[model samples]
Target: MAAAFLPPSLITVIWGFIGIVCPLFAKGPNKGIIQCCLMLTAACCWLFWLCCYMTQMNPLIGPNLSRHSILIIAKEWGNEITNTTTT
Candidate 1:
């Protein structure tokens, strides 16, 4: 059910390909804009996922309760880490 809320594969694949190419290309304003836009879009996606998860998993329960939430959170956090580590 929540899968419906996910970003499309085309969007992801395009972003991934761009991500791979961006580094090889010279650093410039366009590259920075693309990077920023991608990160912003990813963050917004994670937030939407988190909201959907919370709605679906109301009264969350389990051993690593919130595991799904953690995954989403990690994705968001990872962007920050990668940006910092890479640049």
Candidate 2:
């Protein structure tokens, strides 16, 4: 199955350009170092962004709401609180 998403693809392309393309145009004495730094930085930043995005898409934990708080929220939102259980 293929999941079509624009943000992730767009971000990857932008980072790919920065890491792979930008390095080729480096000049001066520290050209190699500059290229290495650019590639490494881009990879780290892209990985971090991807991780955060994936985490948000599928959160590890759900909200833990107390019965009282749930009731309050339900009443405020005009939603009926059917059952309240204590753990």
Tell me the TM-score of each prediction against the true structure.
0.36, 0.69
Per-residue lDDT value at 55 in model 1: 70
Tens digit of lDDT per residue, candidate 1, span 10-50? 55565555555544563676877777666666657656756
Q: What is the C-alpha RMSD, rounded to one decimal, of candidate 2? A: 4.8
Give the runs in model 1 whose Cα sits over 4 Å from its true position: 1-29, 59-87
Candidate 2: segments with Cα more than 4 A from true spot:
1-4, 65-87
For model 2, residues 1-87, the per-residue Cα lDDT tens digits are: 136488899999999999999999999999999999999999999999999999998899999999889888998899968885679
- Candidate number with greatest TM-score: 2
Candidate 1: residue pairs that collide? none
lDDT of each: 0.59, 0.93
What does candidate 2 score on TM? 0.69
